[model samples]
Target: MHSFFRDSPEFEQRKRRPYSPPKVTLAQVRSAIPKHLFEKNTAKGCFYVARDIVCAVVVYKLGWAIDPFASTFGIVSVAVKWFLWVVYWYAQGIILTGWWCMAHEAGHGTLSNQNWINHVVGFLMHTFLLTPFYAWRVSHHAHHKATMSVERDENYVPRTRKDCGLPDELAAKLSDYHEIFEDAPIYTLLRIAVMQVFGWPMYLFTNAMGSPRHPPYTNHFLPWSSIFKPQHCNYILISDAAIGAMGYVLYLWTCQVGFAYFVKLYLIPFLCVNHWIVMLTYLHHCDPTVPYFRRKQWSFLRGASSTVDRPFLGWAGRFFLHNVSHDHLSHHLFSSIPFYNQPLVTEHIKKVLKENYNYDSTNSFRALYRTFTECCFIEDDGDIVFYKNKNGKTARVLADDALDAPSLH
Candidate 1:
């Protein structure tokens, strides 16, 4: 029975194997793309911002007007109303997430050719959304620099069993889900839920699930936190002040319109933005197929190649998320590449890299489930390590032994 389960179609499909990076250089990959694609248009970038903002406003107002009427019907009507409202929230969230991505572009200075324009736009967009522009910019730069380095990457750093800090027995049990939940579906579903809903805020506030290099008290919002240097203190304070101002504005709005109105109009959509942020970043970097490198084995190209480009909601998702999901590997490769050009860049790289390229067309839901369950923690001992399941087996091993294969120039 166990052997049959292992050979099952679902198990085989979700399994991921390690991929070796190509010997091709970034210069060679960049030269393959058309030079015109590198151009950034400030007007075009602002158009996207304008379009998403207008759409978000429409969705918010529509939901606000319909919500009271939806509540007036029967229990079924209330359910339907809520269902519609949640859909609107999701739409609004996607638009706001687009704004967040625009700010992210500003951080990379890819939103426009002008550096000052990037900063000005990034600060306003991020601050309005309660993110500290410069604070997040510095840390995000570090994340891009380190990528999948186990010791240095800022976010989504997985824990080794010993590093997890759970009591020994509980750690062992949680690590090996086969021994605990076994065939129970609820355990998998519940774990994904917790990660999606709570992960982002926890990372921002407590630095939870961040680099182990950081002290236990580390937080993104604190100027003195280990994540930043003293030089960054002023910017961190500015970020906090921006967030505080937004919080005060929210408080005033709640006082004016009541708490429930605020929850429906802004809070739920805000949570949805967090959800997209967590889910996309998690899926991009964490996979059974991807390996994390310690200092000795790490290189920028290797670390950047560790990411996988995934599709969300097809073209609509690509448009809304500003190609962040589909062209992620290219973004990592050339952090300055504008989102408008990333798809073209990715295509060029894919053709040039051929077998060395990593693209996963797996269903997003399936990939999420598999990643959450299978990518529990990596073995701490190896210089280059793949994620291991509870049974001490690697989650997925390439059939060709490609992980040990030599690079081809």
Candidate 2:
């Protein structure tokens, strides 16, 4: 097996140059891909949306039918029923996730060239998933603009050594921040569990990984929150109202169906969707080898360069996730390019960026765990810095030649 920090031969071979800012310009990135991929096919986008919805409905109805018809096999065991329930939730969750990604496409203006049409579809589908569409779209736009920027990137921002309360004296002495309690393996497990289950809601409600520049307790729901301007207050309120309406509908459904049945039918799959989305976004930008930039040394291309393209969930991910994680670097570079068109764009992007392109083929679930444990904190200051683990060691070293003058900013 490879080292947990992933000093894999493939990674080393791909990156002949040490980490530095991207040399590719936005114009160069755009010109690398074919022009037809940039076109938005509204009808094609609608077909995908409809297909996902139909699949979800079929899964839901067939899943319910299992209970009544189980006796046809001569008294189904409780264990068997439980297994089937798990399978149903997994299937249902994936279908809905595909639908969710289509709405995400709308947010990027790739669902259709018609802005109003995109907004309407995004609003409805995101509301169905109980996410605030406009709020997320607005914040997600900010995330893309400032990705990998230590001072400005919106989510999954690495905790700095000072932010984690590591002692400056001890860190300087041993280059380690292994606090007695926090460095324990048991503690890491607990942290990962809590993050996987609660991270999404925590971020949405409290902006957990949001910029520190925001006032304390800033959240996605508030119109006046520091993440938004006064001019965008109406959009924020509309998103909040849509969420409220969706919540009310779910509550009524829960009352009608009863709690246990509701959990089996809806809540379990919804939880899975949350888990998948959180893991996708988190693993894309968080890795031991990935560098996070301080704004003084930041550029759009450099920030985009910092992300890794992961083959999360293999073929299922392609079909169910619209290649959101698999072709993520291309998405970062050309966000308006539709998901269906991203594969070709990604191929050219990898060619253009070459050593700057990062693709980690690690199993997504294992990679998620590895990242959570190893990508702990960055130095309190540096124009470009990679994550350090509890022992304060970086998985990859920056070459002397790669260092640029801080004054270059």
How accurate locally, in lDDT, is each candidate?
A: 0.78, 0.82
lDDT of 1 by residue, 117-174 (tens): 8988888888877778888898899999998989999878878856643335434554
Question: RMSD in Å for candidate 2, one decimal?
Answer: 2.5
Best by TM-score: 2
Top-lDDT structure, candidate number: 2
Model 2, span 1-409: residue lDDT tens: 6665564555556445466555667788778888999999999888877887888999999887877766555555566778789899988888888778889999998988889889988899889998899889888999999988999988888888888777773535353454522457787777877777677888888988777777767899999888888988999999999899988999999899799888999898988888888888999999877788886777788788778898788898888889999899999988989899998899999888888889988767778877887887888988888888777778777767555634121
* Runs with alpha carbons beyond 4 Å of true place in candidate 1: 1-18, 68-80, 164-184, 398-409
lDDT of 2 at 205: 87
Looking at model 2, which ten-residue stretch has the lowest summed lDDT? 173-182
Q: Per-prediction TM-score, please? A: 0.88, 0.93
Q: What is the C-alpha RMSD of each candidate to the true structure, in Å?
A: 4.4, 2.5
How does residue 192 of candidate 1 score in lDDT?
A: 77
